[model samples]
Target: MELGYSDSVRENVEILDVVSASEEVGILDDVINQGESEVVHLKVGMKFDTVDEIYELYRKYAQQKGFPIKKRSSKKDNGVLRYICFACCREGKHKTDSETPLQPEPTSKFGCKAKLSARLDLDEKWRISVLVLDHNHETSPSKSRFWRCNKKISNHVKKKLLLNDKAGIRMHKHYYTLVVEAGGYENVTFEEKDCRNLVEKERHLKLGEGDAMAIQSYFSKMQKHNTGFFFNIDLDKEGRLKNIFWADGRCREAYKEFGEVITFDTTYLTNKYDMPFAPFVGVNHHGQSTLFGC
Candidate 1:
């Protein structure tokens, strides 16, 4: 069956015009309408006027129950949505990193069976058809901050961070101001490191083309000289260099022998660019400090 939006949905959106701008980024902390009558209690026969309404109801329910939700699947008929499914984030298994056996496996998925399915009815309303609420793992609302779905950096906040950076305000101070204005760290959706990353990105963009190109050329030369040389460069949204890391043939060989315990330190700054200097260090057989990579 095909679906259509009801006029009441548009009217409801107009009535909710007073929502905070931060909500435009993603799902915010307070998602449900506060009215006691608006509480979401999913059932097989529950219906919604719009697909967004159904998703909002399910998201609010998942947040309150201390779990994350994601759109599992959807079906469309004649370019119109006919069926949709929402399920716990930990509903499937993740692929293993067989190439890197030492790397730890992800613990997010547990074959969770909790899900809700809805179908468009002849009357155009979405009615729930399947509801499996049992979870294979425990849930806690207190840990909602860690949910990727709940963590968002709104555009308003991004602009504020950028302005503060240009004004020479330290990132920690500005981050603290945001936390205080929001009432506490718990109230803030993002962490201080997130703001630091933004500032670092801006600094990276300020790097001159000569410096970035020179660094790339050096890496290319080294890779050509030694086949075991490996490197990775991170770029910003605008395709500018954000960061880079490299390891020579010797460093990779040292890692194969002393990779069990390695240390990464970034306490120093480069003399020319003033960028943070990090080095990977390992202990040798003679108890000497050996360079792994940087």
Candidate 2:
């Protein structure tokens, strides 16, 4: 069943078809001729004057299996008539000089084009190798959005912020003491009693009273000028303002009136210990103030 070039042959010749009686005799003759100088090798093997007798013996063996004998001219040496039998069940003429060698058709699978080759002589194994080539098919577009605000803010905050997820905006409760120097707020200091009262109420609801007061004061000041407020919320984290019913209702009204609002909703808090605080501030028509509440 094994097929390959004989070790005695110098050239890299591959035997493609099934081994026939004539082929075996031709191979044996080549082996003996190459090793004729060695006496020990010649003594162990029988010498054949003609390949015909060897082919006849092979014919008898093949006849038992109902195989037909064939005649072919040797490509190796011109004018050398060689007797062969088609042992392979499949029907195909032998490849000629003008015909290309048998090779697998190119195919695209497993992310690349693969080439296949069969070697009956070399262990009778099918070898497959991949080659990277440009494909004509179009590639799929990326799923991520180009102007992803959440991704930008998430990178700025060093945290993951998924869109449409419930989130809150508030002052830094634990680091409220640091806001005195942050300079973002208008008034930094309040009475000790006022701070204590606000803290008590905020602690009862687990929210920041100072932040709520800042928002309420801002909106009340804007209301003096009869302005509308429009804003957005980070719906990723749980926050007091995010859950506030009145502030959300007012924002919806403002959106309807102004057609659009310039609101920058971000969660990067000035105080590291505090949650993100999104403050919405904009100017509306008629020189009125548009504000975000809570």
Residue runs of model 1 more than 4 Å from their true location after superposition: 1-40, 94-104, 197-294
Model 1 root mean square deviation, Cα atoms: 15.5
Report the lDDT tens digits of candidate 1 across residue range 96-145: 85677787676789999999999999999999999999999999977766
Off by over 4 Å in 2: 1-250, 265-273, 292-294
Candidate 2, 1-294: lDDT as tens digits = 866656633221211111221232332222111221222211112233344543343333323323323332222225533222222111233333544447644332222221111111233222212111222233221211111110111121111111101133122321232122223222222222333444344434334536656656666665566554433322224445543322445665665677366665666654523454555655667767775443
CA lDDT, candidate 2, residue 249: 51
Clashing pairs in 1: none
